[model samples]
Target: MSALIPALERQPDKPALCFGDVVLSYAQLAGAAYALAGKLAGRGRVAVWATPTPHTALAVVAGVLAGVPVVPLNPRSGARELAHVLADSTPDVVCVAPETELPEAAAGLTTLTVTLAPPADAAPLARPEPGPDASAALIVYTSGTTGAPKGVVLSRRAVAATLDDVAEAWQWTGDDVLVHALPLFHVHGLILGVLGPLRRGGTLRHLGRFSVDGVTRALTEQGGTLLFGVPTMYHRLAESAGEDAALARALGGARLLVSGSAALPVYDHERIRSATGARVIERYGMSETLMNTSTRPDGPYRPGTVGVPLPGVDVRLVDDDGERVEADDGETVGEIQVRGPNLFTEYLHRPDATNGAFAGGWFRTGDVATRDADGFYRIVGRKSTDLIKSGGYKIGAGEIENALLEFPGVREAAVTGAPDPDLGERVVAWIVPADDAAPPDEAALTDHVAAQLAPHKRPREVRFVTELPRNDMGKVMKRELR
Candidate 1:
């Protein structure tokens, strides 16, 4: 089994984690985590009230170090969702910051307040031998589409494999300091954003809350070389960069800027690139699969396409008949199926779901995409939600969304399919107008889409709204639209 973070012991004096003024050196971090790990030893599972703080990071690291699985509780989650996770995971203890207020759902649990700094009057940094890496290390739940969120069990082996794979792909190393304002829950923010830098032996400066000024401070003042954010954050940054010179320069000077969790609309991608001279590299991943593909640091600049499969991941597209779709015409869409060490072990207490999640050992992602001749994959949308079948053509909502985004009047757009009597499924577009008072009308939008794309792919219906329903990670809940 691979060590989750093999480089931690190598750098004792280097700054390992930072949030505002709360900085922990590698020695301090290891000491604190090891100390907490002792208290958490043999605990079946530990639930963390994941706040954007060093305390949250320390707690998660401690849980993994203790050979106990961690279940991150989203701080902003509703009481019902929190209750569901707590009941489902049934963690032995819940860890939170000292001043944090526990919700009604976490009322009856054993709570452990996390203290980051090594007890001043305590013993020296006494590190222990690493624990099991191949066992379940994290039980992250998915955003439920149909039912309650199902726990996706990820192993340390999988974490190590994916991080190393991403490190190789992104040319990441110990010297690269990363910056982001992502939440401490979810895969994008927690596993990748928080633990990723730790595994690389690099410093991560959390912005706490995302803002143009916060990003500027981290990038310009904190020696941060890399930036990780979701499309929503990027969209906001892109908007600000157009007028904020400092933000633009900081972004422009960064070594790499990465966006994930949702498709970065090509419009936003170009807006940032045009201003900052930095291309936003996108990646494809899920809760069950840590990360499968990414735009490599040395690869071509292909916005809208999550680059080729990583080193150890074997990715393929399969038709409805479970046949491989070999036509790399960049048009034939198929569900992405990936097999590698990066895959999760199973869904916790979910044998039936775990059984149906894979086909002959290959985990089915349920995401439809088209792989180009060059091996780059462009995600169309989720097969169950985002793929719109109109006029007998299998159309991906991504391209249509991108087309709609190109219009000057649109600020945000979401596409889905609606059942139609004649056309089986018709494309429906939900748009947030740039100027809501002077919003573009349906006829004009339909024409604009038809002109940009083909007439058949144009939205049959357009609905204007103030905002689209999005999750904590900024991914539009397309099922809500349908």
Candidate 2:
């Protein structure tokens, strides 16, 4: 708390945030957070459900500094999801967005209404000295599709370690201005987007919701230096900027643009670079671990690889037999296990799941990848989702999808295994067509696949769709296809 306040005091006059016509200076931001801390002093856990505005940021900082765990609720979540999270976290206070009704669980709990207006005559609160093991943050939801959300407990040391690693790797400083569009409820936005920048005294411009036009205007008008987004955002931006030389020129000012939350195809990465002249850096990370590895800015940026591990991080490839594979052989593919200070402590209340994830000490990441001779790693696919067995042959869906993406007219493709009595499972391909182009027929696609892939790897069926089903972060949910 003291560190953040002192940093804010040093840059009191600097612009802290800009959304539409509203602009808040550093001092104003600090003051509002201090006052909110005063209001939430006695609260143990508070649930905040508001847009990613300046007020929301202040409230979160204040709650954390006041020794309270802030549970950032997703505004887009349905009533059932919201109820489940509230029941699980059991926050003592509920902070609702302006003009929004309080949840039923807030009947006896204190409700604080958040607004965009700055408080008057507010004084900074006394900074609390928290121990390293203090529970500084709480994110109460998991990404699993089948079960109710589970809360994840993170200590101050864990969050600090993740932010420090990111700040050092990305070369973040006070002069950088981050344009944040991801949802705050997710770890990507909270740890990487909001906390990481603020720790370095950098400013963050939060866009409550993502839209092509809104983000374009911010990049063109706000002089944003850093941009972080999912792959889908980059795809939309590429489409919006195509053939518009002026818009393309406007985007040239950004120094760094990052894509995460899902595997970014090399095709989209190249398209973004060709249109905007900004190299899109792709990285590998997950909700459990805040960040793992990234392509460095000054080093060779591999198109398909997610670069070497970040500082203070260790990665290893363990085969199905649970033995480490030699990095020299590129043919070996195994579970990409990680060990670092940034790894999550455990899955809250899921001892069995947590026990299964950790073997000997390293956290077993479910994704599968192969390390090249040069130490760069390429994520082949998820071990559980991307592995397909058909006709007594084991096939990797990611390899087939990558091959399909190499075709001239194929924009995007997803391959899944369907039930088949004869082969146990058969390959099925779902594709998105290029602009003004009809999808290739089944026979044509089959012939194209046969030309590039082995007979067993060929997709037996082809289905064309306008768009793939994605979650909020743009990760294609393959389970839905199953």
Candidate 3:
């Protein structure tokens, strides 16, 4: 709602959204949202059956116009996860496109079909004032790593603040056409990818599904200036960029390439840079915080670091004893704690969880990382998953994983710790071979890691698999592997 009204007034006929064969101009989008907003004037929170479709985007826009909190339901969520979300949010109505099948979890809620097309003569209504900055605009659910997915209440202020800050940091403007094929259920896709462009009065071209072909076509043919993708998407592009001149040219032509939701391995970063003279920047954030740190366009580009904090965000590294991390030498790892306006207000209906998430005033991110003197942050790993205390030395699995990925035969690598009698916890490397017929030997990989890092940080064991389990955002599901 920050730039929606102005966009409608200024560039009413400009392309706002493109999905498949359907293209909706700003005027058309405004008309559809206004009509739906009038009908939903007095409604409470609404649940959107989030799909990579125009209808889903329209529903979210309408909800924002109506000043109603929107909960984006994952289209591919399991019955139990869906039920949990519906029950927790308890939306007054669920919105979906016509002929869309509602899951068993949404059976009892009042349902409304969002019409993709608006009447030709429907006039834009008076834009409603977004109630308050503290008012909840979205109720995005967490990944449920610890328990049931907790609803993180994001305020209108937070969304506007984060997007505005990102726009400045990335030098984003209305002239840029953003392209991505990310799922709309998460913060990266829906908020940053979709809403971010609208906030800038820019165009967005969404690929229905991610593929190297789709990315290549969008960048080369659609006048796409900015590209947003996860590590997996970039990895695919990197794997093929050397052979595909069009793909490489398309990537090299993009104004900015962003990789988020998870870290992009140093190997992939170098590969993409080698093929296309463009550096893919990484960022750090979560459902609780829309976005914390991201590599800036004007600053130095580091391969593995998730750059400095955004304009209005403040971040710090703290030790287990709740003491500030005094060393900025880039080796001492500590839990990341952040405080800023871009953070979520609370965990819906879970005050206890919310209270526990904060230490003093900073929200404990649970992600362990290191900071260099230049204020750049390098995430070591998660406190519960990535930190390996082996032989009395704390080891961050990220560096080891990066080292494993450097091997010619290693296509994918994830590092974790396993119990050992003498070492307490031993570094374990999970590898997906580039060529199964001629995978790198375990001893060679171990030596490779030891040579790159300290000998103590080397993997004690190596496990080869066809693929590593990853979530929608391309984050390796370390919990599943454990």
Which candidate leads the pack in TM-score? 3
Worst 10 residues of 2 by lDDT: 1-10
Candidate numbers sorted by TM-score from highest down = 3, 1, 2
The alpha-carbon lDDT assigned to residue 292 of candidate 3 equals 95
Tens digit per residue, CA lDDT, model 1, 248-354: 99999999999999999999999999998999999999999999999987889888999999998999999989999999999999999999999999988899999
Q: What is the lDDT of residue 40 in candidate 2?
A: 84
Off by over 4 Å in 1: 120-134
Give all candidate RMSDs, comma-separated: 1.8, 2.6, 1.4
lDDT, model 2: 0.75
lDDT of 3 by residue, 1-482 (tens): 33433565478889999998899999899888888877776777899999898888888888877878899999988999999999899999988888988877778789899996887766655655575473688899998887899999998888888998898889999999999999998899999988899888999999989989999999988889999999888889999999999999999999999999888889899989999999998889999989999998778989999999999999999988999998999999999999998999999999999999999989999999999999999999889999999999999999998899888889999999999999999999999998999889999899988898889998989898899998777899998888
By the TM-score metric, which is better: model 2 or model 3?
3
What TM-scores do the predictions have? 0.97, 0.91, 0.98
Clashing pairs in 3: none
Question: What overall lDDT, based on C-alpha atoms, would model 1 receive against the true structure?
Answer: 0.89
lDDT of each: 0.89, 0.75, 0.89
TM-score of 2: 0.91
Order by lDDT, highest first? 1, 3, 2
How many clashes show up in model 2?
A: 0
